[model samples]
Target: MNEKEIQTEIESRVQKKLSDLFTTYKTDTDSLQAILKWKPVVLMIGNYSSGKSTFINELLGQDLQRTGQAPTDDSFTIITSDGSGEGLIPGSTLVSDEKLPFTYFKDFGEQFISHFRLKKVDVPFLENMAIIDSPGMLDTVTEKDRGYDYMRVLGEFAKLADLVVLMFDPHKAGTIKETYTAIRDTLPESSGEDRIVFVMSRIDECDSVSDLVRSFGTLCWNLSQMTGRKDIPRIFLTFSEAMAANPESYSEWKEERNQLKQKIQSAPEFRINHILQDIDRQVNEIKLIAEAMNAVARKGRAKLGNTAKFGFAVSLFVFFFLGVILKGMTGFPEQTFLAALLGGTVQMHHFFVPACGVAGTLLVTSLLFTKWTFPRLRQKARNSLGNLITLETDYRKNLWSKVENRVNELLKNMRISEIWFEHQTNLGKIVKFLNKDLQEFYERIRKIK
Candidate 1:
């Protein structure tokens, strides 16, 4: 199917099946839909002077971004085509545009917005895609230094992009603190494993093939440590041909550059599948949350049931002997209600006082449970949230890790009991969407030529 047709089909399926699920579970569909509506995005991230912009310029066949050995650009510049001419849009304006998927960036504050922009070019290569060029990652740089969290901003962009190219140079070999943090923490949360391509750019600068091999080995070891994945992802070794005077000398790896460029161009092809996977992952996250809530609800019900049982026993005792206890304590109304009952001297007028006493006892018991007992139980459940869900499998554990904070936030700020009962039903809907409707969508996408 064509791009528009595929996009429409995905949208139709989500609206018909998963839209309500997203809203009920508090997932943001606006950002998801906004990402769907825009052109496919290719996010470029790497160390300072890692040839990210240089490679982008090569792909666009023009000098669109400044090139330098040091960190050249500090702004997040989005380069795309309008087919008219060159133009620029500021970050403040870009975030306000509902048509784009960048509204979340406004939360990063004015300092970050001042460093964000969009550049429109007339290049044919960008007619169907947009390239986001980020400020290079640096070592030992704190969030206070940037006035915003760099890895966080990267993660947000990574979440929206169809393809993320993490470029590196032979000089650094992925040892930078920020780079380590991104691989270790951010990408796993934002982008899927398949969406990121590891590229070791500027390989030609190595003194020898052996030197290059050592750098590659170092990078592999570091990646293993950072990602904790035994299998190392494919890393493209490339260099800018424009900067290579001895092009013939580096002919062996020149085709790798072309292949990387081709991969970037093919980002649009990745768009549909990426969207499907993103939606699936998000829906599953909501499902995981619902499961935890169901656990909390179960705990809560058990606690309340125990309390009710105890309270019922107390109420029965009060109903039978309250008058006797009162008479014993104050020596008033000499005959107990039980004494009247056994002696067969009870009248309808005599029953009123004891009946009222039993009713008042029950009311006080209910009030104590509601006001004092249940809140403490809820707080205890919140404290031991890890015990709520059975994360026996690795996948369940990982999913729990992702939504744990969100669940904690909800439990802390909201009355979870009020909303907890619907979770079981929500779980059913989410499961049906994932196992049935979403699988059908996957099949339909696969059938597309």
Candidate 2:
């Protein structure tokens, strides 16, 4: 299949899965919708003056993004093709635009709004894919300075991106705290390593071949510390195409630059894997929640059983004591009391009235147990829910803990006994989709050229 065909199929599968998820989970599917609203994104992140904008301009063959020696651009720009006449759209308007996928970005407040933009240039390359140019990372800045969570915003983009370009230059060499924190803490642990492509941009800055080698080694050491990976990932060495005139030390890495460009062009092919991996992770999270709900349901039913046993026993005792009171006061149904005594003489005809009285008393006791005693016990259990979650494995316990609030919410709206059955049924449906339907779609994409 071609890139367009692959993208169409992925969207179709994700839509089907999301429909099932919405029906089963009974929550907002806004997050899922956001991912599909935009085309495949290749997010570019790096320290200041890493020539990220330069590389982007060279690829597009147009200077749409601002570039300089020092942080020339502070805004996070979403560059794409504009069918409605090429222009720059402000963030305030962009968030409100339904056609765009950045509505959720409004939560970052006016500070971020002031710093975000959409650069819609009429480029042929953008017709196939989109590029996100992040604000240049600096060692001195904090989340407070931006009046919003910068790394968090970037992380959201990272989650949405099919490929992430983490670029560096000889000057910084992977020493920035912002870069380290992003690698270590922001992106999803399992898939981030595979999705991210490291780039040593501005390779011409190196004084000699030996100098570039030193910079490469430094980046490797820093990456090992940040990612905790024993083996180094492939880092693309590239410089701006404009630097083609007598690059003293950069002459050796020209082939590497061409290879990097080729890799970037092939980014659309990687989208198939990213889409599948994202779906897998989301389904697994739901599975954990289902298992936890099942656990809570089981615990609740057992407690109800115990309560019924104890409550009914006490009710029976009360009925017996009341019968004795009535017999002493008015000698009502006197035959039952004497017959119940082992030494009393038997009178079958006289036993009829007492038998009728015992039946009525037991009926009243059963009603009280069902209405008041059972409900009260369930209420108490609801308040102390921690005692009810019986899980065997540490992984299950951890997953349950993360989704504990969701379980509590479900229980609050309905009986725990009902939840277990519903969750079990939903889990069966989800597992089948993941194992069979989702697998078929993924295999088709993998088989694509």
Top-scoring candidate (lDDT): 1
lDDT score, candidate 1, position 351: 66
lDDT of 1 at 66: 95
- Expressed as tens digits, the lDDT of each residue in 5-117 for candidate 1 is 87787778778877786766667665477678789999998888999999988888888899898878899999998788899999999999988889878999998999999
Task: For model 1, give the 10-residue run with minimal summed lDDT.
Answer: 183-192
Cα lDDT tens digits, model 2, 45-120, are 8887888888888888887888888878888998888555588889999889877678888988899999889888
* RMSD (Cα, Å) of model 2: 4.8
Predicted structure 1: lDDT: 0.79
lDDT of 2 at 151: 76
Q: lDDT of candidate 2?
A: 0.70
Worst 10 residues of 2 by lDDT: 183-192
